[model samples]
Target: MLSIEGLRVEVEGKEILKGLDLEVNAGEVHAIMGPNGSGKSTLAHVLAGREGYQISGGKLRYLGLDLQELEIEERAHAGIFLAMQYPVELPGVNNMIFLREALNAIRRARGEPEIDALGFMKQVRDKARELNLDEKLLKRSVNAGFSGGEKKRNEVLQMAMLAPKLAILDETDSGLDIDALRIVADGVNLLRSPERALILVTHYQRLLDYIQPDRVHVLAAGRIVRSGGRELALELEEKGYGWLSEEAAA
Candidate 1:
């Protein structure tokens, strides 16, 4: 569903992603594990079409279309969702209204009718419950007063509601405790389908234990230096990323 080849990205004249390459097909879950400053989040943001990052080299295609050509909203309408590492707070904006408008906009772009208020509320409530997110938070501003775990669950809630074709989750497990992690993972697992794909950018292997990835990649020095199966995550957990960095340097 997504193709990235030799992708080099720079922020403010400094390169973050250097010659990174990855391919994620439908029905596949890929985990990207790396230490600090390895450009994991850069890849996720670039895939989501976030601006300010100069694409210095290579191509990124989604569903056979050049992703760089699409605007951020266009990317979202095209079924690309990025659950950010830190979900921003939009004070004074009702969470439910924001979600409904966003979902309706995507639906409208797809030539589908907008969901009615009742339907939207029901769907949001159901999804919130599934994610173990407090229904009351929907009435508040988006992530305004939410705890770290709450914010992460809110991100997953958005993912569940949008039903994107390719979901890029950047550190969804970063601040979550075991309980919150399981709830978020279950929500993610529920969205898994033969036609959907997920790219999880994480620092720890614990997240992979809940949502088993088809492939695990060690990204160091801005490129994927090693790719393997679930066992790769286990090995990383046991050995850490030092070995991978040394190997990549060698």
Candidate 2:
């Protein structure tokens, strides 16, 4: 579903991604594990085509199209959904309004008719209930005055509604307690299907316990140095990144 080769990116005149290569197939869940400053988030940002990150060299393709040629919203409309580590709060923009507009925007881009307000609300409300989100939460402005857990749950809610082909989650488990984590995980699991893929970037193995990614990757010094199965996450958690980085250097 996604292919990246020699993906090098620089930010603020400093190189972050040296030469990262990764591929995520359809119906697969890939986890990227790295310590701080390993460029995990950088890869996510570049993939989504965020502004200001210079692509010094590399090729990224999604569904066989050159991803570098697409705009941020274009990438999103093409089924790339990024659940940010920090959910931005949009004051004065009601959550339901934001969701409807987003859904309609994607629909318009696809040349499909926009869903009526009633239908969109029903879909959002049903998914929110299944995700165990409070209906009131959906009525509030996007991430406005929300707790950490609330923000994360909101991100998952958007994902559930959007149903992107490739969902990139950057540290979705960063601030959640066990209960909130499970709530978020349940939403993610519900969204999993044979047609879509998930890329989970995390530092710990606990989230992997519930999700059980098909593949795990260790990124160091702005590149993916090691790739393995589920056990790799366990090994990294037990031994720490130093061991993995040394192994990569060797």
Candidate 3:
């Protein structure tokens, strides 16, 4: 559903992605494993159309349209979702209100009718339950006073509610304990389907144990250097990225 070819991105004259190539088809989960500063987050931001990065060279095509032609919200309206590594805390905005507005905004963008208050509440609560989130948490300010795991689950809850065609998760497993990791993974697994695809960017292999990817990619030196199956994550865990860096250079 998403194709990125020869992507070269620069932020303030410094290049982060150099000829990075990746394609995520519908119904497939691809895990991008890389060490620090390997451009994993940069890739996610570029896909989401975040500002400040210039696409010096490349083509980003999503759902058959040139992604460069769409704005950030336009990309969201086009069914691209990014679950951030750090979910922001909104002081006055409740989670329920946040989600309803977001959902309706996308709907309006797509020329669909808005959901009423009652309908919106029910759907959010149901989705929250699906992610095992407490009903009261919905009433609280978005991510305010939430634990790390709760924040991650809330991200999943948003993904579940939005039901995007492509979801890019940038380190959703970061700072979560085992139980929370499993919960987040479970929520992600439930969303897998022939109509959807996921790009999971992570630094470790433990998350892969719960959510097995169809393909594994090693990102280093601003590009996807090597790719393999699920076993690739295991090998990276055993041998580390030093070997892959050598392979990539070779």
Decide which is better by TM-score, 1 or 2. Answer: 1
Which lDDT tens digits does candidate 1 get at residues 90-146?
Answer: 999999999999999999999999999999999999999988899999999999989
The stretch of ten residues in a row with the least summed lDDT in candidate 1 is 42-51
The candidate with the higher TM-score, 2 or 3, is 2
Q: Rate the local accuracy (lDDT) of all candidates.
A: 0.95, 0.92, 0.94
lDDT of 2 at 68: 92
Clashes of each: 0, 0, 0
* lDDT score for candidate 2 against the true structure: 0.92
**lDDT (tens digit, per residue) of candidate 2 on 56-172:** 998899999999999999988899999999989999899999998998898889888999999998999999898788899898889999999999988999998988999999999
Better-scoring candidate (lDDT), 1 or 2: 1
lDDT of 1 at 159: 94
Tell me each candidate's TM-score. Answer: 0.99, 0.98, 0.98
- Tens digits of per-residue lDDT, candidate 3, 1-250, equal 8899999999999998999989899999999999998999999998999999999998899999999999999999999999999989999898888999999999999999999999988888888888889898999999999999999999999999888999999999999999999989999999999999999999999999999999999999899999999999999999999987888778
> Candidate 1 — which pairs collide?
none
